[model samples]
Target: MERPELPLAQLHAFVVLAEELHFGRAATHLGIAQPPLSQQIRRLETKVGHALFSREPGRVTLTSAGRELLPAARQALTGLADGLAAAREAGSGRAGRLRIGFAASLALTVLPGLLRTFRERFPAVRLDIQEMTTTPQLAALRERTIDIGLLREPPAHDTDLAFETVLTEPFVAVLPTTHPLAAQRVVRVEQLADSPFVLLPRAVGPPLYDRITSLCTGAGFTPRVTQHAVEWQTVCALVETGLGVSLAPASIRRIRLKGVAFRRIAPDTARTRVAAAWREKDPSPLIPHLLAALDHDPSDGPRG
Candidate 1:
């Protein structure tokens, strides 16, 4: 047999009567007269192909079928209400989840404070964070996998992504405590040009690695690279082993290695620019809240 189409109005009346078990009270709750409420329930019973309630002189009792349908009817009505609310929010540009990407290094410094502030302001917005390299972060932003990015550098390609400088961090030299240079108050990049160095991995960005090498060159000689590591922690670990010295952002000083000593790099040859990037044409309500959060600088020392 074909199922009859259910009317929303009759469904509402059925739900009310199912709960109150009295047509008079149900009508009062629905703000309708009892006669019309009774008529609507009768009509609904016809459509459903079964009597929902047994009507005696003074009392009304639900039939077995009515008991079975009550929960389902309530669920359907609740779902409809929720769907309507979500639609309204979407139309107003105030709903949906926002996915944000961040480079690993930035997560140690600025991301936490930004996230805390954003959550406080936009409690309804869902935030999803992905930690990725600068290259992949830009790619994710372009592909719509992420709505925004906190990264060390601006995008290399000319996509429609806009970037705002969030923070600038100076460079510091990391060396084993036993190394002679570790005893100096401040070390210059040129002074370490002849020392073995642990370099950032080539995949991190040849340009960035070359920039480090170029700084050494400008200091007067080529660096003797003794090891290569992908992450700042790995580079610090290698330095602790007396493998070589490395130039890293001042934030790296936060990562305490007992054998590793960090000193300011003279002339500040090591500095990295960090920015918040997003797609120019993307529309997301949470963006403004996130931007506001990123605008508030948190006073923190570099360590991770």
Candidate 2:
């Protein structure tokens, strides 16, 4: 035989009647008339296959079945209430998992502070972080593999994706300690015209790679790139071994390599940008909350 549904309304009525042990009082507590409350108790008892209350001449009292049903009914109502509250929290972006993709280099700079602030604001939200390079991060955002991306040098035009610049830092010179230019407090781009360059390949980060090259070109010489490394640390390691010099975002200075020196570029006008990216019309509410957190963070640079 098919099971009868234990409707919440009926169970609620049962618990209230069990507590009051009086039809009129329980109906008053439930904000209903006495007859409807009596009918609810009768329906619940029918489903339970037992009489729940004994209506005597002067007093109403619980049968053994009603006593047993009270606690379990109360528990079911409490569990439903908790579940509904959690669902509301998740809908408001205060709870749930947020998948994030970021460039590897950003971990050394803005990533830590951004994540800390997000966690403090929404402690119940779980962060799923993926470290990837710029191109891959963009692809991940497009594929829905990541909900958002923190990457350097977002593309100039993408109809399906939207980007907001979150950080900008001027480029600095990376050189071997023994290089003559390293002795100077600041280096000029034109000064490195004769030196070999160790840089991240254009394919790895085209916009950043092109920006570095343009700086050299503006100084009247194209960089003679003798070595290519996919990561800034590796590029710095090559420079330390005297393979060549490089120009990188100021944050690259955070990598402490004894043999390499990072010096400010004179006139410091040119800069590389880092941006937060997402699908143009992403439906996840978490994205806005995260963007708000990024905006309020002290470490976030001026938006572009």
Q: Which stretches of candidate 2 lie over 4 Å from their true place?
A: 1-5, 52-69, 220-222
- Residue-level lDDT of model 2, residues 176-244, one tens digit each, is 999999999999999999999999988878998999999999999999999999988899999999999
Evaluate residue 108 in candidate 2 and report its C-alpha lDDT on the 0 to 100 scale: 80
lDDT of each: 0.81, 0.90
Over 4 Å off, model 1: 1-9, 16-47, 53-64, 86-96, 122-127, 220-222, 300-304
Q: TM-score for every candidate vs. truth?
A: 0.77, 0.84
Worst 10 residues of 1 by lDDT: 295-304
Q: For model 1, which pairs clash?
A: 171-270, 251-302, 254-303, 255-303
Alpha carbon lDDT of residue 18, candidate 1? 85
What digit string (tens of lDDT, one per residue) describes model 1 on residues 64-163? 9888888888988999999999878755546768899887776678878888887887677788989876778878888899998887756465558888
Q: How many clashes show up in model 1?
A: 4
